[model samples]
Target chain A: MTVATAGEFGLISRVTARLGAASPLVQLGPGDDAALVAAPDGRVVASTDVLVEGRHFRRDWSAARDIGHRAAAANLADIAAMGARPTALLVALCTPASLEIAWAEELADGLAAEAGKVGAVVVGGDTSASPTLTVAVTALGTLEGREPLVRSGARPGDVVAVCGRIGYAAAGYTILSRGFRSPKLLVEAHRRPQVPYAAGPAGALLGATSMIDVSDGLLADLGHVATASGVGIDLRRSAFVVPEQMRDAATALGVDPYGWILAGGDDHALAATFPSSVRLPDEWRIVGEVLPASLFTAGDGVTVDGRRYTGGAPGWDHFR
Target chain B: MTVATAGEFGLISRVTARLGAASPLVQLGPGDDAALVAAPDGRVVASTDVLVEGRHFRRDWSAARDIGHRAAAANLADIAAMGARPTALLVALCTPASLEIAWAEELADGLAAEAGKVGAVVVGGDTSASPTLTVAVTALGTLEGREPLVRSGARPGDVVAVCGRIGYAAAGYTILSRGFRSPKLLVEAHRRPQVPYAAGPAGALLGATSMIDVSDGLLADLGHVATASGVGIDLRRSAFVVPEQMRDAATALGVDPYGWILAGGDDHALAATFPSSVRLPDEWRIVGEVLPASLFTAGDGVTVDGRRYTGGAPGWDHFR
Candidate 1:
């Protein structure tokens, strides 16, 4: 049935009933004006992101469930990037009156599935009718007595590392944009990102100094770290392993795979810096090194080896 | 300059720089992937709401600053309705690329102003370019060792009370819809609601067993309390003191003021139930009583003067 036919209260009941009881972390759940969650350590890590239908995802390119999963991943990755364990998620969804109830249910199913990956719950959310579809997710996490990882903490002598896939989503995006159907796995990577949730808190425990999630492309995200820490980052081109799938897709599209590797976003990978003396975990691989500000011009926040990236930073800009 | 000219990072810096330092509740703030907020009591209350540009507000009807203020109030009121003190707000805004940079700056200004009312901070947010404007806000609160006031706790003999302005915003909506230019106060109320921020925690301290914000409408909100508590709510018609402004506007529109009083929403007033023997604080006025479930038909969740509301509860419905 369409949501418009079933009505608001009925739709809320159906969605909440499908969501089941709140997890143990939630002291109070749905049916209340707000959900109460246990924050244990007297602190909570919070972040939010909004996904517009056409701008963030295409209905034709993504399933309802995939859209939901991707939205959850984006916010959950932010919490993880802060070196906190994700505890709960609150979703605010906007859709049109003609939307099917099944679509929303599928979206909820996807949200629950992704949230369950890290043992978090969908605590509460709001739904409204709009001319277009938009999904806004807010993820909350608990530090569990550990200090949060911030971008500003990176030191000049630190080693930069990344855990999880890079350039795959970009490859997927290119394949889809070019209407090439091959490379199914790369397309899947663009649809549902497998964010490294465990690696975040693990990195903090392993004495990582600073961390960030790869949402706005690697170089763009690391640029945030560089500016915040007042240090320059020098990435080794040889350290990156170009997957056969990305290479194939790049060949098919006649575009440089390295561009996607450097600029592609939505991968939700963990980019962090560790002290030079610390042995990095198996989940992380060294990709670059943090350098003193004097090593590069201020305009060149991140350098590819000793030379500046002549192509400039390849990244997503919301307004551009 | 437009956001398209300044770029995403530049726009974010402009907004955050204007916001200045973080509040005491925020352990970490902007520039990080996520913000860390002190929750003190080990429990956090969270609520989220999405406001679509045309559905919730119009750029022509309200200023950009007012839109931000209203969005903050909507989510903050939900936290207050749950009987918690608001701590922080995370905003996710989607606007078109051609939006003036001044509009975004004014929006941040309004957000900061409203958050400051309850000593809450705008810790972090996401911005993206979309075809239309949408503002989604999530408010986090601390219980501070108090149990949240859920809807299920009202007893048969409990007194129904209300705090803050009721029916004003709805009246304002009616005025604006009909194209009446006079009664500027009512119009202002509709543009930016004055939610009773302190009354929530105060109600909890005074032993409010059940509560909800009047965003949907007096009768509609009370109906939730009734259904959740498995009791009937009987409001006294004469108890409500019609404001001179509302009365003047109602007369001008040739509509029953009670229609606005009973049905008008977006007022964000506090409606709550307390034990019959307790004296409500000055902030609250006794407006009704709780009755046994057997008192009326199952469909008559809320009544006025011991009779089922014949006009069919006036309230906002998203799909309707």
Candidate 2:
């Protein structure tokens, strides 16, 4: 039956029943007006993100579970980018009343599964009826008393590194747009990003100077760091090792693999900068170096191999 | 300029500039992947609510600033219902690209104004382009070393009371629905609820057995408390003192004022149960008492003067 027939309270009960137990950090779970979560560090880190139906996902292209994963990853990655441990999640969903109840239940299951990967849980949420389906998630985290790895801390001599997949999601999107779904790996990447959630706190422990999740493409997000920290960033093209499967998919799609690596977004990869003296971990691949902002023209702080990028559009902008 | 022409970053900058300085509790504010707020009591209270266009609000009836106030109040009142002090707010805005930039700015002003009343600030948020305009807000609060007053704490012998306006919003809504807006007080109440922010913590301090915010009419929300606490609530109709203006509006609309007081929602008044021996503050008015759950039939936990409420619909449901 559709959600309209089940009603708001009935749908809530059905979806909440599918969710696993909440995290220990959640002192009070759902069934209350508000949730109480432990903030052991005396400070709580919070972030919010909204994903619209057509703007962020298409139901035909992805399953409800995949959409749930993507929505939760968008906000959870933000918390991880701050070098914090995610503890709880709050979701506010707006959906057409005609949608099936099973879709929402699967969505909740996906959210819980993704959150479980990082030792977090869905504590509470709200639901409403709207013409377009929308999911807004709020992620709460704790820093464990460590200083946050903000975007403004990168220095000119810091080494730039990345610890997760890049360009795969864009390749997947291209595949789906072309109606070719044989490449399951690439297609799944577009559906649900494989975020390296642990790498954020690990990099923070390794004394990373600055960090950000690659949501608006690698170059675009790094541009934020360079602008915020008043430094220039120079990337080496050879640093990104293209997977054999991805190369085959790119060849089939007739596009440059490096373009996707440079400008593709939605992978939620962790990109960070560290001091030149720091020993790097095996998971982090050195890709670039920070430079003095004075060396570049104003408002242009990112380059490839010490030259301006000749790739296509730099990144995603909502209203643009 | 419209949001489409201004772009996402430009609109964000414009709206954020209108907000006042951050609260001291916010260690790190906007312009980051996440915001860090102090949670001094070692726990944080959180809640989220979404307002959809033409559902939760109507742009033709209420200004953008009023909608903003209403959205923020809905979530902030949830935090207050838990007897916590609000410290921060995070907003996720989804809007049509054609929306005016000034409308968003005014909305930000209203959010800041409402948050400022509780010594909180807008710390961070996300923006997206959507076919419909929607605003989702998440509020964070701290308890300051006091036990949270949840909905399941009431006993059979407790006194039920309410603080703040109960029927004003419903009255205002009725007036506005009929295409007559001469009564400025009722119309304004419908646009923005004046929540008794301090009364929640004060009631908790005075040994409240259970507390809730009246969002779904007096009897309907009280039904929630009754179900959670496993008790029955019986209200004294004589205890209600309908405002003279409300009575006049009810007479003009050819409706029952008592129905509005009993079944109306969205006033955001505080409803709580206290031990019979506790001396309540002057703001609270005794209106009802808790009874054994056996006194009522299954799934029926609220009564008006020893009988089931004869009012129309009990409360709102997003999907029905």
Candidate 3:
């Protein structure tokens, strides 16, 4: 219903219907102010993200559909990181009342498009008038009788493995930052990331030790696993750059690939510490190992290469 | 820590403590860009809402704390309406960076206060720079073992009942519209809504024929139920409007008390249809009966009291 190519129901109808077609956890999907999600385990996995017009996405940088995808991908990745299967999504959008209605619809199209990739669907949301376009999304996932994988579960000597690409989102971000104009792959990465949507549950199925989504840089995110587990994590520079997709934007930007690989964020990749014997998925690779709290030699929470990445740009700080 | 009443910590400290609170359902709560929610029943319920500064609330009209409470209440109440117990909340805030840190903190206080009432904790959220204050909340709920109660379950011959006050919110809104000066009761209702949070699950337990939260005016909300259920609902205006409270606001607004009683919305009350043999709770009163479609009408495509309330203000359109 949303315009796939040219003429469609615009963004509202198309995206609404697309989401509607999915098996809803609740009794309803879009068209209402909110969607209903079901929780059978007497528990639910929930998360939210808000994308501002200029802060999270740029109209000049993305198609409306792509924006929707980015929003869904961001939130869905959160649910996935919990080792939960994404069930539904709630989205509230605020934009200038005069903005193209089609644009809003397209955004939904993008959202449905991305959500479909992981079998997640938009359930419900709100709309309002505002000077800037703000998209707030909440993703829900089912635990499916499994214990949640938490950041605190990492223990010393647990092997740190990633289920998706790191630094690629940052690498993609670097390309956009340099004012490059191709706007295909990198821009798509920035707009709609293909996070290892299923890898989260895969890790959980394998009894993952601890898990997380890589929205922030690997160092910072892994640092959280360290702090939560009350242990330390030491990255192997050797294993850090094994992935080459990270090199594209690094070469283009003339910056150290390690920074993006280690400190760049927004890939929505899944990172978890597993017992050394746990088998990892194909994309997954050993990046580090959990250490005793006193043994952390990264020295004051710097990247693997010992480069400090903090302050306003230490990945995506909401306030900064 | 957000008010003069007690101890508070830096944002970082507060976020840190909340992150570790253990719950079997929560794989993650905070310390990252997003938190994970476990879906029981292999499904999850998701919904989102965005509140604008002046359009949704006026700083002069409602305390920042109250605004925070209302924002959370609105969405949490929605999840409840689906017969779901609220589990986690994600918030997105966009405000003028120059706003006092206290304002933001106070807002957080309000959010935590109300979220506590629903047994839901704030999990994770994003904060950013904006010209105006914006609070967007996404609430997730678990359905447990029962099927979700939806607006479409009502059938002909079902008894229509309500579990909370119908027009109190509209009455309160009227007071705010008249100029933020009103009795404490009226002002409080506008600032903080008291929803029948328990009744939603109760409805599930009671085998509600169909249900919906009375958010947009009783008639409007019923219309949704009727449309969804493919049935008609005939309300006995006589059932609504008890003396003390209705008189209290009516005296202030000096309008027909019935206007607020029937046309006003945002009460967050639960309206449901049930079998006639089911004993209703004292907190609820039977107001109508579901009939075959085309049996009742209000305004436009709707009918109330043989009079159509067709001055379409548009019960909250999306994208403003």
* Candidate of highest DockQ: 2
In the order shown, the candidates' DockQ scores are: 0.85, 0.90, 0.38
- Candidate 3: segments with Cα more than 4 A from true spot: A1-15, A24-43, A204-208, A236-254, A275-282, A295-313, B1-28, B31-46, B142-144, B203-207, B242-256, B275-281, B295-301, B310-320
TM-score between candidate 2 and the true structure: 0.99
lDDT of candidate 1 at residue A277, scale 0 to 100: 97
Writing each residue's lDDT as its tens digit, candidate 2 over A1-320 gives: 88999998889898889777667798987778899999998999999998999988899999999999999998899999999999999999899999999999999999999899999889888999999999999999999999999999999999999989999898888888899985899889999999999998989999999999999899989999998999999999999999988899888888999888889889999999999999997899999999999999854599999988888877778876
B1-320: candidate 3 lDDT, tens digit per residue: 23112211134444344334445666667665356666566555566778898777888888888988888888888888888888777887787656665677678788877878867777888666666578998877777766778777888888889997666766777787887566677567877888888998888898897777777677777877877777777777777755576687687567777777676666778888898888887987998787787755444233554455544442433332
Each prediction's RMSD over C-alphas, in Å, is 1.3, 1.1, 4.8
Give me the overall lDDT of model 3: 0.72
For model 2, residues B221-286, the per-residue Cα lDDT tens digits are 898899999999999999999998999999999999998899898999999999999998889999
Candidate 2, residue B73: the lDDT equals 91
Model 1 C-alpha lDDT per residue in residues B1-320, reported as the tens digit of each score: 98899899888988887666468888998779999999999999999988888888989888989988999999999999988999999988888989998998998888888988999989999999888789999999988899998988988999999999998888888898898755988889988999998999999999999999998889988988988999999999999999898888888789888888888889899999999888887889999999999988756489899887776455887877
| Candidate 1 CAPRI classification by DockQ | high
Per-model TM-score versus the true fold? 0.98, 0.99, 0.84
Error of 1 at A79 (Å): 0.7
Q: Please identify model 1 stretches exceeding 4 Å from their true place.
A: none
Tell the DockQ for candidate 1. 0.85
